[model samples]
Target: MRTTVPPQEKLSLNVLPSEVWRWSAASIAQQIRLGSISCVEVLQAFHRRIDVVNPRLNAIVHEDREQSIGAARQLDGLHRQDSHARGILRGVPVTIKLNVDMAGEATTNGVPAYSRRVAPADSAVVTNLRCAEAVINGRTNVPPFSFRWFTEGPLYGRTLNPWSADITSGGSSGGASVSVATGMCAIAHGTDIAGSIRYPAYVNGVVGLRTTSGRIPAYHPTTAQRFYGLQSMSAQGPLARSVEDARLGLLAMLGADTRDSTWVNAILEHEDDAEPVRVALVDEIPNVVVSDEIKKALQQAAASLVEAGYVVERAQPPAIDQCVEIWQSIAMTESRFGMIAAVEETGDASIMRSVHNMAACAPSVDLGGYIKAIALRDELRRKWNEFLRAYPILLMPTSCHMPQPWGADLGTVDEMRELVAIQSPLIAVAALGLPGIHVPTGMSNGLPVGVQLVAESFRELRLLCTASVIEREAEAGSALNYTAS
Candidate 1:
């Protein structure tokens, strides 16, 4: 792994007593274990950061400072008693998305009507973070029902992109990305059904990992049974400022849970020989008008990988359009049966408009059609799996266009159709249950730009290794330059 100071750390170094907020989760954990810092001091630094920045960003919608401080005190006592009591993420301050279950907290999911729907117990992800001794500072915001790409609703208002308020802070993980980018947390937990995790990270200039569907067990104790779309497509993962920190967060969240039947015990890392690996570089889609900036980002990432001992070739996966269609068919139809009524009744205006536009873009499907789409999705997954067998890593654009305007998804149905075409890269990977990571390259025209890397299911280690290489190059001049303003 390459070691270099990230742009965020460079800025933090100039300030007194506030540098702790910018340290990576790995560094924070090690420092706490070595008795260099107490959990109370670490939590205090983040609390100060939240107070200074969160008012403008609106990233962390819910906070429990007293509870977090108490947890930190208990952790400090444990560390004093047993020298080996440190978990992998011990003393690391983190934020959980509001959509997940947290005991005594409302899983409002950005819906005003559900503000009173408190969770009786922690979700599996929260339980894993607590087991890892991570301090949950607060709950981040999301779109209502987490159904839109832009993060804004009646409940939490909006999460501004630290780089530019005019551009979106991509959802449904918008707050997760913003919180991590602005140093409010070392790591932020995010959930991705479509591009929720990856897109938010892309726009906010952070690293987001959309793990394989079953890599991290997920369940919500406060909600009803999950829809089929969410069950097969949604993934729980982490967003952080660096690839190593993201890996640390992932390890802390992985474990077996009886609540989620889809949880897998797959090996986390694959053995590597000394030979160079093949990487398929996908810079353009057949019918998609990929912006020049996006293509340039992909080329730069590919060049970095080639210099790091990987063979890069131009190749496109099979049936990408079909994959998008199948994704929309299954996801939209499932929502129609399971969530439309609730959304119409309780969702905010933004979600109501975006959901209707999305439904209009999807081809109407009956029960048999939905089932057939699910079957076809498996076939597409097999084809992509075969493609990935030859190419261990596939480099592509995170989005075909640059960061969009704040309310881009609330436009006409035809506009949403166009948006979907540009977002095919994100949809295809989610549809196939593959693992992908968004690594920021640098800034372009005052906004962050980045590339996406996809690997075979359960091959996150490969993605992380490759992402670190590109990230080192990004350290030269990346958007981590943005400080909380």
Candidate 2:
């Protein structure tokens, strides 16, 4: 299904910090640090925005007005650290994907069954952000079991795209991306096991980062273990409206945590203008039908970057299909062990059964295969590293298809199978554990399009530079089509 984007929202230049929710995270941080706005003021700004837009969009499932306000209230004079005021994100209003934990909040993961079960403490991502003084405005939407590419809860129904209400905001992190896109939060935190971070960013016309695995330490309140494969594929990153916000979000979230053994040595050589980006325009790499609109956008972005003095080549990516299978073996095994256990324990198996049954397709490997998967995963890492020895960046469509409708069919049975196929492009890219950036480039039917930039480990600086160049080109051409309700 296609969607026509409505006109862009009427943003007031007067309130720069609160104007576009996409960059609001960084904007509010600056305001709070400069004392131009108090933490309470910034938090209240976000709260008011939620009240204004969420009912129409349904992007945020649960919100805490009092707690958000209270957090902001404590941010008064945080700039004066000598006076004992504390807040790293002092006054910054942020949203967490419902899949993650926040104290006293339910890690719903978009399921109705767990709505009443509250978390005892924050996830590591949340704790790190809080340590930096960010106020948790609310929990955003997710696909049921946090698996699909569309946000619909048997609990909350649907999360409509803010730019075009009929279309989706993209899933797993759909609600978070939508909330950030439409001024709900400055930035929203999202997880990337597959393409949760990048696809949503593409659909929402924002900046989303999929940091290399082990870069941003991931920890939930409940789990203490992450298997090697899961550790390799499982990484958490940030989604924001702007490149700098993405940079700041990554800086805030990347830290060592006890829960994840893989989270270590984040001493990345951060460089914005990292030489000529050896880029490959991998169009339809795995035979996925690349939409003409997306293809045009990719080609346009590549040409613009080339004109901007970067070396661009239309080459093939590392064996994305093989990488995907390796990733699937690991991901499905972990899913069965974790999600299936939860399903069986509950016995209230509706969506749970569907989730488990789907996971059953790629059951865990034997000890030998497990060892081989690890060996192969490492081989892929080295292969990508070697490829980057030549090319620094890769340009591609974040997804082969455009954004689906709000209540699209990515359900149980056929739905699960379809999503598994549909999500392949993102999963294929993500399986390699590289840093990919989704930069909003153009629009169609009032919705947004993004150019996906894949870079080697620690090449995020180069990716951001490419995005900055693309951003300038896009701005020089046309602004994003932000159709308001």
lDDT of each: 0.86, 0.72
Instruction: List, residue by residue over 339-400, the lDDT tens digit for candidate 2.
Output: 76665654443445546546654536877876787788788878878877777788887876
What's the count of clashing pairs in each model shown?
Answer: 0, 11
User: How much lDDT does candidate 1 score?
Assistant: 0.86
Shift of residue 192 alpha carbon in model 1, Å: 0.5
**Residue 342 CA error for candidate 1 (Å)?**
1.5
Task: Please write out the lDDT profile of model 1 over residues 19-75, one tens digit for every residue.
Answer: 798788877887788787899999999998888888988999999999999999999
Which regions of candidate 2 fall more than 4 Å away from where they truly are?
A: 1-23, 80-88, 271-273, 341-367, 406-422, 475-485
Top TM-score hit: 1
Clashing pairs in 1: none
